[model samples]
Target: MNFEIPPGLTDLLQEFTVAVLRTRPSNLEAFAADYFNNLNEKKNGPLKLSGALRFQENDTVNIIEPSDGHGSSNEDDDDDSFVGPPSSYRDRRKSVSAERYDPEADDEGDYTKVVNPKSDEQRRRLNDAIKHILLFRSLDHEQMQEVLDAMFEKIVDPGEEIIAQGDDGDNFYLIDDGKYDIYVNIDGKRKLVGNYNNEGFFGELALMYNMPRAATIIAASRGTIWGLDRQTFRRIVLKTAFNKRKKYEKLIEGVPMLSSLDMYERMNVCDALSSQTFRDGQQIIAQGDKADCMYFVEEGNARVAMVNKADPTATVEKEISRVGPGGYFGELALVTNKPRAASVYSVGVTKLAVLDVHAFERLMGPCMDIMKRNIGHYESQLLHIFGDKANISDLR
Candidate 1:
């Protein structure tokens, strides 16, 4: 039968083969089968296989084809016959009886008993696959191996909720097998948001920000996953050559509007700015909606619009301006604490720093006191910006 191996699986097989050869066994075929079987029993049957070849029991003495198939023979077949100590042999027998069984027949409902034995190469492939997923696409070979030692793997059945929206997320996951669907509840209905495949990652935003899960992820099929909890992931990211938060703080301090603030107050402003991400075309702030926070553009672009009051019967949307990186918007929300005068929608993948009312209150308290002391200075500035039409009655 024709079978094709995926690039990922082939790499895994190579690793497994190396591991098995380091602890060489007498019968290569038997060792391979035993190793495969053990992995199957441990991982259940979610593991996939390809390029498998088996030998008939009676034809063991005949020359078996090597993986390269160049007519080489096993010269040590006779001399390398396995002879285990009595105690070891008995332990093996007992383990086989206790742990090796058909998952379908087991009353205990354990799912991992169905793994068939695999060749040395296949075992290596499985191990490589696990390592590859733990490291994901960003880490290099050496880093990947280190991560493999620290990571843990698990198999989950379909319909399992890996993370729930609104819950504190402490772990991030990389898919090794099967698929998953992501959803967010909108207007009382679960709306499909995204899908994940092998090597795909989710729950990263929560890990970075320590916020609640923004969406719920459900296993779409029997899946194998490699996950690292928040503590470990944090250590890895923070240990990198560049710290993202520190870099962002330095950039924010350079902005003219924030230059008046000292280093401590600037840090407080940064702390107040919550990390928010949105997909293209997603509405960030609705027109005429009660605004509670100011937003600073960190990445991507957004269109600002206000209702065109020209036609009273029909609602009109007029785009006023486009805001992008280093540009700030929604300052009115921070000051007036009133409804948003305009709506903003993402033009592409967008990241924003949102400063809410509570954060603004805390950070602006001392600054406000300073402004009150120089009331005439502030009043002149406001008058120059907004003429006689500007209302200063609300300030008192």
Candidate 2:
């Protein structure tokens, strides 16, 4: 009988090998278990592991999540061979059990409405404050307005417990006016672990992953906060994500090079995209620079320019072509793993969807041959303009 090794297993083993060699953990069994566990959680959704269990060279204990008490002592026990003292092991486990969860699981729930008592001035200020937060930055204008309306204000007196450790989290809070202290319960005592002031946010870990609060937050002064309840937060964030994917999928579908990709492949490409914007005349990709990411024009246009690389004193660039919406550029470098062949500048106020090189290699594997065949066509156009003085190979 003949058997074959799965295609994905090779890549998985290669990744695991690199991780093992980099960390040099004393216990391979424990490290493998922890690595695979983290990988699985990542596949399901975003996961934030306790800092104590991060795969640093000096630390090897697994990240502890809230455990069901029914498991046997040994079943729940840390590996005896794990580096560090026994007390240290126990203390690490005592940190907030930040659970892993799929945010999409709650997509069917109705969005909760919070009464907006804020005046015009307050609403403007709140919008300014949260507009830059990573979680809210990707939301569209309409969704952002919904977020602002759902977040209600809360007033807390000095020394009030905002959230208790080990309790289920219901709201994600953003501080507006005063200070708050973060504490972790260790050995039946509250230990001051960190602090947050105006503009700082907390409780997201629990709400994001359905985990218990990892730490207790107490108001250090008479402070004001903006809170979005769990149901509303999930509804906004997950819906925005879902809509963005559908939008990008449609964009990917229209690109000529990616036209050959199947629906599932196109969806994977869509998931890897991130959005960026540039002002008129801003340099998007510099010639001779190593390429790390490729760009697709989502809105407005970009100018592709190239210089005579063979002449050291040739500083002027000639506009070679324009890339309008639904068109893509910067892929030559990603396909060849070389320096950019030409500089790309924003023609006007441009919005771009980007995919990094790693994602390009992983998701665009099926399109590699098609991309390579087009490289000659691209170079020929450059040759027509520069008349062989450009030495395009060096620029590539």
Candidate 3:
């Protein structure tokens, strides 16, 4: 029950963890669930790894590991009983539309090896296929469309291995018709674990890295599937993030406050930003509220005001400033969680690039490191600008 993970596999786990983090930032609970399942799925059947993180979907993540992850072997796990005969497979195969893909048909002028169904049913299913995964749920409608666009259909025959447990993963698959039997190898023998039918997906982790497949999936019948290669999948998954980062780069380029930073440093700041939108009358930052994030206006307008503490319900607020596209507020908040000095509200509908405290620190680490290395030089420059005795030790 206590299978020790090989030392070499540690790197694979770390790499997998980073990909999951990038795909879904700040959701450690989801990471734990997916990570453990990843290791468990790779377990050599009755012999399993015990030290992987233990968790459930809704449960709080726990760092403790169970003593044993392995379950006892069953005599009923025989491969013959699990895998039905070729004739039985043909019976199920008859349920699917064979006209969709002709085995004898040659692709004389087609761009793909598999033939797509004439109806829109496959496209609808492909869109619905990823709805259940948390990472996909984070995507907006347009971003999700990119994922669907990246995918293409593949017609597979019965008994063919869609993906083998030890093979390098280049594609993430979603079954469109028929089924696949999931199998894991234990001591060079394949053992059936489960089955995937229409809409079921696998190989999502491949979008991040080309690790070996955790389990083997064999076609139970001549079936249709939609698959996205690693390159296309990665582009879809990272499109929003990279797109926003590029947008921020352009936005930051126009901000005079960031002019002192080098291009690379400016990019670091841009990469930390996350896009946000505000409805009319929505308060972006409230007076006396903790300042944990800042915003850069992408569209529309906003008004800055100060609350009248003497008359809490006063109809008139002290209007301090008005800013539109390419403008920003809460710069001090990125450095520290101090109480906001004023309030900001959307004048109409507004879109903004927001950077929370964590992201600001993370993407700006390199810039901070450079400052740390040149602290003495910076201190002298500040002192020269002010006076010989100017205080610069606690610049934070």
Q: What TM-score do all the candidates reach, one by one?
A: 0.35, 0.57, 0.43
How far in Å is the alpha carbon of 198 misplaced in model 2?
A: 3.1
- For residues 277-308, what per-residue lDDT tens digits would candidate 3 score against the true structure? 89999999987787787787889999887644
Give the candidate number with the greatest TM-score. 2
Q: Point to the candidate with the largest lDDT.
A: 2
Error of 2 at 130 (Å): 1.8
**What are the lDDT figures for the candidates, one per model?**
0.52, 0.67, 0.55
**Stretches > 4 Å off in candidate 1:** 1-242, 309-314, 365-396
lDDT of 2 by residue, 30-149 (tens): 887777665655354454333223333544443222111111111121221222222432443333343433433544545456666778987898888887554565587887888888
Q: Output the TM-score of candidate 1.
A: 0.35
Tens digit per residue, CA lDDT, model 1, 31-142: 6666656555433565444321213344222111111111112121122111222232233222111112121232433322222344555445445664433223333455
Q: Point out the higher-scoring one by lDDT: 2 or 3.
A: 2
How many pairs of residues collide in model 3? 0
Model 2: residues with Cα > 4 Å off, grouped in runs? 1-112, 246-272, 276-294, 298-303, 306-327, 330-351, 355-381, 391-396
The Cα error of candidate 2 at residue 80, in Å, is 14
